[model samples]
Structures are given as C-alpha cells and as structure tokens.
Target: MTTVSVNLPATHYDVLIDRGLLDSVGSLVAKQWSPRKIALVSDDNVAPLYQERVAASLAAAGFDVHRYVFPAGEASKSLTVLAELVRQMAADTFNRDDSVIALGGGVTGDLAGLLAATYMRGLHFIQIPTSLLSQVDSSVGGKTAVDLDNIKNIIGAFYEPDLVIVDPNTLGTMTQRDLVEGYGEIVKTAALEGGEFWQLIETIDSPAELISNAPELSARSIHYKASVVMADETESGTRQLLNFGHTIGHAVEALANGALRHGEAVSIGTVAIMRVFEDAGLAEKGITSKLRDRFAAVGLPVTDPLLNSPQVLDKVKNDKKNRHGHLNLVYLTAIGHPEIKSIPSSEIASFLNLSVTN
Candidate 1:
C-alpha cells in the first residue's frame, strides 16, 4: 500500500493506493467518518464490475450503503444527469451527515463529487477511481463539475473528497486509448517537473505496461498532482500550470464535438503548444522534435487539431479561461519548467493557422 496527503489550508485529505483495496475501503474510510450513511455513486459500466464489493465492504464497516449507477461518459456529465443524481441522493435520504463515494472514472468522480458538494449544502465523499486518468488527476483534486448545455465541466465546485482509494488492478479492464490518454496527462505533468518523475515515464512508454513493473510511480503521479493543487487550490493563479496541454486540448475536444476523449485532445494540445513555441523561437533546439517523437511513441495525437481551423479557434475563444479575451497560453521552456503568457486570440489563431497550413 502507498499513501500520499494533500494538505491544503481549508481542505486536507489523504489518498491511499493499493491493489485489492476496495475490500478494505470500509475499514479505511471508517477511520474518517463513523456513521455517515454511505452512498456509492457509480457509472453503469463500473457498477457490475466492483460496486457490490464496495457495498459489502462498507456494510462490514457498519454503515448502510446505497449504490446509484448512471450511464457513463463525458456527455452524461450535465445538468439533467446531475439533477437525476441529486434526486437519487434525495431518494436515498442523503444528508450532510451522510457520505458519497465516487466509484468510477473521471466523469463519475466529477458528477459524484459535484452532487456531494451541492447536496444539503455539503456532504462527505470518497473517490475510488477505476481509471488511470482519474486516479492521477480528477479523483484527487477538489475540482468537481458536470457539463452544462454541452460545455465540459461547466458547473463545478472545489470540494475535496474525504479520502481517495486507488486500486491499480482495476486498470486491467481499461482500454489502450484510455491508458494513452492518461499517459498524456502524466507525461505533461512529468514534463512540468522532469525529475525522477519524468524518468519514470521515459522508462516505460506505456502506462499499462508499467502495471506489472512499476505500480509505485504510477501512484506517485498523484503525489505530484497533490503538491500542485495544494499550492493553488482554487486555480486562480499558478495552478494553471496543470493546464499545460488543457487550453488548446479543450478547444480540440470542442472542435471534435466531444468525439475525442479529454486526454486525447490534451495530447494533441500539448503537441500544438510545443509546435507554436518552437516556431515562435521559444523552444530550445531539438526540444520540439523530442516532444513530438515521445508523444507519438506513446500513440498520442499531436496533429488532430489541423482538421479544422475556424472551429478550433472559435472553441478556444469561447473557452472560459480566456479572461480579458487574451488567450493565456501555458508553454514550456523545458521539462520541469513552464511559462504562462496571455496572448491575443487573433495572434494565436494566425500562428496556429500557419502551423496547420504548411
């Protein structure tokens, strides 16, 4: 078992990672809140796989458990789904004294955590992430939200989970695409702090391939993320470093009309940022080529954004992070170092257009 802590000013919590940890979640969680009724918020795909095990564990810990399963996907994250989730929580008689467990990937965790935050002002929650992406990012951070009217994570809040239990073995069922998507975030983060962490990524091109060899560093990614979020919890400032590939990534996903997974778009976004930086003379020699090569070696897309011009630009401009209408671009000087600049949309669009054109 491996453990890490996110010690923030207002929100402090611990994350526990271990294989077969689900069977012990009740005892592990019982250490936090004793009698809060437990609600397991799960997606349809995951409930059949491990929901019952979690329920049994919670029951053994001496709490009544309610499992609410919903269809899983980024599209399911929304006002309607959230409303239904709230109704289900209400039907379960959820209260501030009760707790909810997010028991799936990023979407499930986001929705479940948001529902917990809004229910009766606030409710206790735990994240039992089953996906690599969620295990390393969304499941730990307090940024929980549901898509509203097609905008990704449009309506969310900063509510930390009481505990995060990560069982890497659950990843056995994950697809290669999801694993690659997760690698994009991990590699981006590692590049943001290319120390031993980045070395860990370089040692293994495939995260799934690491499952049998290096589960510890896979869990260490959470520690890296925890440090970043703790320093900038509300994301009003430096926390944007975590948005390394996310800015244009979000735009790419929007351009795809939700056809691409979040991380895949992010992979493309990272390459786009690298390309623009190199072209503008911001990147070191050979750096851009290395980034592109590494990303491709991992099977991530760095050129998917070239498919559309006006759509991509429009999506990026519509992005809510563009405060003052200046695109705040997160770029890299090297792995473990980054620079955030606020550039005009017209200039960015033109730069990207040129990159796509030739």
Candidate 2:
C-alpha cells in the first residue's frame, strides 16, 4: 500500500490506494477535517457498488449526507444533466463549507467536480475514482467538465478536489472494455514519466494483473500528473504534453457521438500519432510498435477504420486543439522523451493515413 498526497492551491488531499482501501474509507474520511453537511454524488452504475459504503462513512463521521445518483455512462456528461445536478444541490440547500463527494468513474468525477466548482460560485469536493482511468488521470487533476454538442468536455472548469480516495479494489468490477480504455492513459503517463515505468508496465499481461497490488505504480503516475499540473495549471504551455494523442482522439470521439470511450479512442489515436513520428523519423526505437501491441492485447484498438471517413480529417482540422489553422501535435522522440510540433494542413492527411490504418 502506498499513500500519495496531492497538494493543489485551494485544497490538499491524500490518495489512498491498495487492495483493501475501501474498507478503511471511514477512518480516512474521519481524519480529513469535519464537515457538518455533505452531498454524495454518483451515477446508477456506481451507486450499488460503493455509494452505500461512502454514505456510511460520512454518517459515521457525523455528516448530514444527501445522496444523488445520476444516469450512468459517458452520455450523461452534458448540460442538461449538469443543470439538474446543480438543482439537486440547491434544493438540498448546500453551502460553501459543505462538501460534495464524487463516487464513481471519470464521468461521475468530472460532473461532480464541476458541480463543486459552480455551486454558490465554489465549494469543496472529494474524488473516489472507481475506474482505473479516473483513478490515474481525470480524478486528480481538478479538470472537471461536461460535454457539449458532441465535443468532449467543452463546458467545464478547473476546480480542485478537497481529497481523492483511490481504492484499486474498486476496479475489480470493471468491464474488460473499461480496463483496456484505462490502459491507454496508463501508457500516456509512462511516456511522460520515463521508459523505465513504461517497461515495468509492459511485463504485466492483463489489466487485472496491473491494477492488482500496484499502488506505487499508480501513485507514481498521479505524482507525474500533479508535478506537471502544478507548473502549468491552466495548460497554457508545458501541459500540452498531456494532450499527446487526445487531439485526434477527441475528434474521433465527437464524430462517433460518444460511441467510443475516451481511452479507447486514445489508444487508437496514440498509435496513429506514433506512426506519424516514425514516418518523420522522429520516434526512437520500438516504442511505437510496443505501445500499439500492448494496448491491442488489452482490447483497445490501435487503428480506427473510421479514419478513412471523410469527416475525420475535417474534424481534426477544426478541433480546438488547433492554433490559427496549425495543429498542435504532441509527438514522441521516444517513450519518456516527448516533443511538441506544429504540423501543416497539407501533411495532416499523411499523418491521418498512418493513424487511421493498423
């Protein structure tokens, strides 16, 4: 078991990760100051698993717990749902000192964090990430938002959570699709941190094996994210590295109308982008092929047949990640050695070709 503390500007919290951390949540919540009133937010899918236990923890801690469960899946990330969530908070009469705890995967963490950001202008919240994707990336960054008009996370805010509780045991119930989707991000973090960590992950054959008792690996990934976020909170410059394959991935996701999970699309996008690096002679050694096969082995697609679709190129050209018509491309020189480059419109099709094909 390894415990990592994420110290953001507004609030500081600990991420407790291990096989049996869920059973200890009550004691953990007890140590993190006392809030008289608390709003516990989750979706239908997650409520049955841990909501009762989370609510019980708050109850034992003497908090007035108000539970709200939204619909499950990525489709629920929208304005209409967010409006109703805010209404629920207002209807419950929650105030500044009171806190909201997001208990679910990425979808729940994002929507709940945004609720904390907007309620009465600002409030406190905690993140209990059930899925591996949420546990490593979305839950800790304070990047909260809802999707708008098919664009991923178009409406949102940078609201830090009061605490983040990551229990790997919670990942026991994840679907195979969900676990593979998360491996896309796990690969992304390894790229940023270094090749050594990436190599460590390569030895693990399945998502279940990797998430088993690997708190140190998980915490190390979060630590890399926090260190980068602390330096580039607004994502003005340096943090663009985090967008490695997301540019094309988001475009594909929007076109699919949320058909593919974020990490699933990213798995394909990362492979596609890495091929671009290889074509340009910018990539180092075997990292690209390794990434492609590793994610594929876990059920994440490395190639998108949809890449041949006409709209794919158009959407990439128009995505917000573009700057004055130039696409901000995060390409790899090698695993752990990332470089950002601007690719011309004329060359995008070639990169798209490599990215779209297996």
Candidate 3:
C-alpha cells in the first residue's frame, strides 16, 4: 500500500493507492469521519461493476449508504446533472453532516465533487476514483466543475476531498481505449514532472507495458501533483504548470464534441503547442518529433484536423487560462522542464493554423 499526503494550508488529506484497496475503503474512511449518511455517487456504467462492493463495505462499517447513479459520459458533466443530483440529495433530507463519495472516472469525480462542494455550503467529500485518468489526475486535484456552453470545466471550485481511495484493481475491467485515454494525461504530466518520472514512462514500449506499471506510475503522478497543489492551491502561481497540454487540449476536446476523450485531446494539444514553440525557435528541434514517437507508441493521438479549424481557435479564446486578453501556454524545454508563456489571444489563430507534422 502506498499513501501520498496532500498537505495543503486549509485541508490536509491522504491518497491511498493499492490493489484490493476498495474492500478496505469503509475502514479507511471511518478514520476520517464517524459512520454517517454516505451519498455514494457513481455513473451508470460503473455502478453495475463495483458499486455494490463499495456500498456493502460502507454499510458493514455502519454508514447509511445512498446510491446516486447517473448516465456515464462527458455529456453528463453539466448543470442539468448537477442540479438533479443536488435535488435528489435534498429530497433524501441530506444535510451538511452527510458525505459524497465519487465512485467512477473523471466525469463522475468532477461532477460528484462539485455536488459535494456546493451542497448545503459544503459536505465531507471522499473520492474512490475508478478510471485510470481519474485515479492519476482529476481524482487528486481539488479542481472540480461542470462544462458550460461547450467550455470544459467552465464552472467549478477548489474543494479538496477529505480522503481519496484509489484501487488499481478496478482498472482491470477497462477497455483498451479507456486505458490509453489515461496515458495521455500521464504523458503530459510526466513531461512536466521530468526527471525519474519522465524516464519511467519513456521505458513503456506499448499499452501492455504501460498498464503493467500503472500502480507505481499512478502513485508518482499523484505525488508530483500533490506537491504542486500544496504550493499553488488556487492556481495563483506555479500550479499552472499542470496545464501543460490543456490550453489547446481543452479547445480540441470542445470541438471534438465527445469524439475525443479528454486525455486524447490533451495528447494532440501537447503536440500542437510544442510545434508552435518549435516553429518559433523557442524550443530545440526534434523535440516535437520525439513526443510524436512516444505518444504514438502508446496509441495516443498526436494531431487532429480540428486543430486547424477556426472553431477551435474560437474555443481557445474562451479557455479559463485567458486573462487580460492573453492566454498562458505551457511548453517544454526538455522532458523534465516546463515553462509558461503568455500570448495575446489575438495571435492564437496563427498558432492553430500552423502545420503540426504528426
């Protein structure tokens, strides 16, 4: 069992990672809060798989478990769903003392976390991230939100979880595409983390090899992100480094409209931004090519036609990173080093129009 502590100013918590950890979640959560009403929030797809096991564990530990399962997909992350979940809890007579436990992938975690943060002002929140993307990235960060008008995470808040329980065993049932979806975020994060973390990912020659190392890789990714969150909890400073591929990635994701998974869009986004830097001579040549080779080896997309669409540029202008008419773009000088550059929102068209040789 590996435990990563996220020691922030206002909230301190532990991210426990281990196979078969799901069975022990009730006891683990009991250490944080006394047995109470637990709103076990899960998506329809995941509810049938492991929800019963989780709910049983919590029930056995003396907590009243209420199951709230919604349709599973990116489209489910919206105000309509959030309202429905919130209203359901209200109907059940829930209050501040109750809790919210997100029990699925990124979409589930993001939506449920927001439900916990906003319900009755705030409630004790717990995360049982099932997907690789959720387990490694979204599950740890306090960043939570729902999409608005095609903008990703446009409405959200920084609400840290009281406890995060990660069970890599849940990943065994994921489809290959779902597994690769996570590698996109892993690659982007490892690129920013650099050093030993980057080297560990580089050694993975295929999707099989990637999954084989998921337990250790997930721990390292969370550890790196926890440090960043502690330093810049509200993204006022260095935490923006975590947005490496997200600038263009979010735009691509919005344009793809569910055709691309979040991490897949991020995979293409990373290549596009690096190409812009390489073209400007701000980064060394061949770096973009290296990314292409590595990303392709793991079944990640390196480029997409929508990247050149005017609609994508329109989406870029609305990204959350934009401030005072400029948006911050994250690029790598090398595998282990990332730097942020702010560019005028007006100039994003040219960057999007630039050819990204995949």
- Model number with the top lDDT: 3
- lDDT scores of the candidates, listed in order: 0.81, 0.80, 0.88
Order of candidates by lDDT, top first? 3, 1, 2
Ranking by TM-score: 3, 1, 2
lDDT of 1 by residue, 261-344 (tens): 887887888887777787778876666676666677768887773445767777777788877768788888877788898888
Runs off by more than 4 Å, candidate 1? 305-307, 351-353, 356-358
The TM-score values for the models, in the order shown, are 0.95, 0.94, 0.97
Model 3's lDDT to the true fold? 0.88
RMSD (CA, Å), candidate 3 to true, equals 1.3
Per-residue CA lDDT of candidate 3, range 1-358, in tens? 9999999889899999999999998889888989789999999999999999999999988899999999999889999999999999999999888999999999999999999999999999999999999999999979899988777788999999999999988888999899889988888888888889878877987888866898998999999999999999999889999999888888888888789998898899999889888888888788888777778988888899987677777777778778899988889987878898888899876665555433
Structure candidate 1, residue pairs in collision: 191-336, 192-336
Q: What is the Å distance of residue 289 in model 1 from its true position?
A: 2.3
Candidate 2 C-alpha error for residue 180, in Å:
2.1
Score candidate 1 by TM-score against the native.
Answer: 0.95
